[model samples]
Target: MTDREKIQQILQGISKTALPAQPSESLFDAGVLDSFSLVDLVAGIEQAFGIKIPDSDLNPRQFDSIEYIEKYLSSHR
Candidate 1:
């Protein structure tokens, strides 16, 4: 599957709900993510993409949405 598809699957696993229609939609605002789940999201992304996310870069704004997550992965990887 594609990167976005992997992201969506990870999100679904964390949220246990349907993904938001808009890729740019805020996962936090949509109730798809919360403070606790953010850690799981980070772990999922790292495992799926095979990239280690530094603890210093654990800001929520950097991972607020699918678009943002994709951008982060592209830039970091």
Candidate 2:
């Protein structure tokens, strides 16, 4: 799956809901994710992408949306 697709699936798995049709939608504002869910997202992304997300570098802005998360992963990878 593409990064966006993987992200959507991860978000859906974390939130137990459908993802927005638009990849730009804010998962946080849309209530699909929250602080607690962000934690799950981090773990999911790390495992799925095989990249380390240092706990000390946790930043909500890096994961505000699918676009942001994808970009962050690209840079990190």
Candidate 3:
């Protein structure tokens, strides 16, 4: 699967819900993710994408939505 698709699958596994309709939708605000799930999501991303997500860059804003995460990964990768 594509990276976005893989990310969605990972999110679904962590959140146990369908993904947001819009890429820019807030996963946290919408109850799709919480503090606990966010940690798992970050770790999941690191493992699934094989990219290092620095602890310093673990801002909630960066993980706010799929679009933001994709942008961050695209630029970094």
What TM-score does model 1 achieve against the real structure?
Answer: 0.95
Quantify all predictions' global Cα lDDT against the true fold.
0.92, 0.86, 0.89
Model 3 Cα displacement at 19 (Å)? 1.5
* Top candidate, metric lDDT: 1
Tell me which of candidates 2 and 3 scores higher on lDDT.
Answer: 3
| lDDT (Cα, 0-100) at 28 in candidate 2 | 83
Q: After superposition, how far is residue 59 of candidate 1 from its true place, in Å?
A: 0.8
TM-score of 3: 0.93
Q: Which ten residues in a row have the lowest lDDT in candidate 2?
A: 16-25
Model 3 bad stretches (over 4 Å): none
TM for candidate 2 is: 0.90
Model 1 residue 62 distance off true place after TM-score fit, in angstroms = 0.9
Per-residue lDDT for 1-77 in model 3, tens only?
Answer: 98789889889898867788999999987788998999999999999989888889999889889999899889888
